[model samples]
Target: MMRFIKPFIMPAVALAAWGTALPASAQDKGPIRIGVPTAIQLQIGRDTQTGVRMAIDEINAKGGVLGRKLEMVVADETENPEQGIAAIKKLTADEKVDVMIGGYTSGVTLAQLPHIARSKTIYMEVGAASPAITQRVKSDYDNYKYIFRSFPINAAHQARGLVDFISGMLKDEMKIQNIAIVGENAKWVQDLVPILKKGATEAGANVKLSEFFDTSTSDFSPLLAKVKDSGAQYLIVILSHASSDIFVKQWYDARFPIPIGGIDVKGQDQDFFSRVGGKAISETVGNFAVRAPLTAKTLPFWDAFVKAAGTAPVYTGVGGYDAVHIYAEAVERAKSLEPDAVIKELEKTDYTGVAGKMVFDETHDVKAGPGFVNLLFAQWQADGKREVVWPKQIATGKMIPPPWMQVQ
Candidate 1:
């Protein structure tokens, strides 16, 4: 009695399907082909893929979803949007993947959305943070039924959490009247500034300079000099894994001394810290999704992930892992892999995941609450531990602002 919504051919489907024939056995076989774009090149992507692999292994080890073995066809998007769309087309058209997962960059994810909807296959967004994904879904409900996201929207919630942490740490602790916001000039970050600004103002922090740079920019001296002269007590740094490492190192070399904190710090995975060296990460504060004191629900996932990845799990891994489980649970709930049914089941999901609880809102976005607000501010201590310093309830340690942040 299972039913499926037929695929709607969008303009790109024809463009993508040229010279390619659809798989014949795709309708009869139960093998779920999952298309994953290349995110493994970066720390976040690597961690995400590791988590996904672990989840798939676990699922397969146990009895696979919908009585079908899960197979993932990973394509290297190489951080290109067009390439990502091509990958989706190949997976959906030639490979006939039932679902698609993996898109680290918002741009890549945005570009692939049209193709995903057209194919009528489920697309579980694991790592992209652009709010537009879910917002568009809400706005265009009928057109975007097959899309679902599993990551935090933008830096808004985390940014607000960072501001609250800074305010508490300052406590008249310092005359931190001015602040600077620096992020990669991407759609996600561009959309996040206003949210960050509102949160900073609520915390009594002034936005002195808001700047954006290309993700490929290696040198940050010019930006650092501007920040140092801005009279800002704190700097909010938001960039991807590679650019963030470069900025942190350049900022340290410049000896600007202002306490810098923001997204892309802990979110990039521990490899980022290791790449920058422990000394560089010390005394820094930023928002992170998964931190220590793993809850009962997340501990098993952590253990499995570490064992599979051969390293500690990062925040991005948690999202990727949870996305798989959430998708599987939805598949089971619907007892079918039909896109619409799976989406309906996804909306009803209330499972407790590593990130906390997973439940999709009307826009197929995870509802905001403990799971959504898991964003915590932490400082890297001397003992090589990044201790939580904000939201008193879960904080494991105190906030230690650097000397530059202290008012002379």
Candidate 2:
């Protein structure tokens, strides 16, 4: 028999509260506090907050984990790196949270890494794609083992799928070959570009020009002109924080003839096409979910999120949902609140979340590829509809070039 899930209401006094904590029994009477530090102003934060709260509400409704109710305390880690570090401190030190979930923007996430290690709080990083985050764990496990990136597989890992998709799909369909890789000057993109270059070159694709730009560079006209002049058949972008709306609109309006593809983080939002006034047509971007039933839990989570948030969740929103459940399962397996015990259980997790089987490798980063998590490239079709167009088996539609470069 299935249990009916209820929609969660935001608590009135969440930040000002503390769970009861005293000398407790084998099963602590106090609630397990889950601290969330993310950029509340951005879609990533708002949706992630909803996902975490939804998971917590579900567990509590089912009598909670190990007889201890779960609660949440949130600290807004605005886009600023300083604010992000302070939010980490607040959650770890002042709030005394049992486990931490949430992070966005690589720079801010990188700044909070040391603070998280110092606090020794098991942080399930639901966002942030910098490979450096988990490389620290591989480089020095004793201090960094407390950290784990639960979602959005690292940038270096993402490159493999993107390269294959760009070189294989476009070439096979439209006979397009040359690629000009442009990325936002951010840590995760920096990590991704090199891997992308290597993979594309090995796939017999030409790299016409590879350049990066600052996140604040609003005018993409000059760069668009450069890509146009470079004679590249396709434009592979690695933008996360840069003005993608402006860049994409410019790309579409300019009719550069080069189809855009790669990891445009902003384009992953469910309402991106509508939000951008439908300029993202024919733009294929890397994604985590497409409201498809990848697993049994996938559609339930998606429907619940829509019912609660009044909109479809962005990528990190799903990450936040998976992180909470993963945390609770780890704690239950260990039967203890201690970080070390839970860490052991988390390492052995084979849980099938919305995306796929989330199994962590030795580096504590989620595994990517066959039978694990595969990077899905989704295209924004006509009228704001998105269709997964890669990995053929699960692809909803085939990749289409912009009207300027129509396939024969």
Best by lDDT: 2
Candidate 1, residues 149-248: lDDT per residue as tens digits? 8765455555555666557654345456788888888877777777777877877878889888887898888888898788877787776634666677
Question: What lDDT score belongs to each candidate, Candidate 1 first?
Answer: 0.68, 0.84
Candidate 2 per-residue lDDT, tens place, 194-232, comes to 999999888878899999998999889898889889999
Model 1 weakest lDDT span, ten residues long:
9-18
Q: List the residue pairs that clash in candidate 2.
A: none
**What lDDT score is found at residue 61 in candidate 2?**
60
TM-score of each: 0.85, 0.92
RMSD (Å) per prediction: 9.1, 5.5
Best by TM-score: 2
Which parts of model 2 are misplaced by more than 4 Å? 1-28
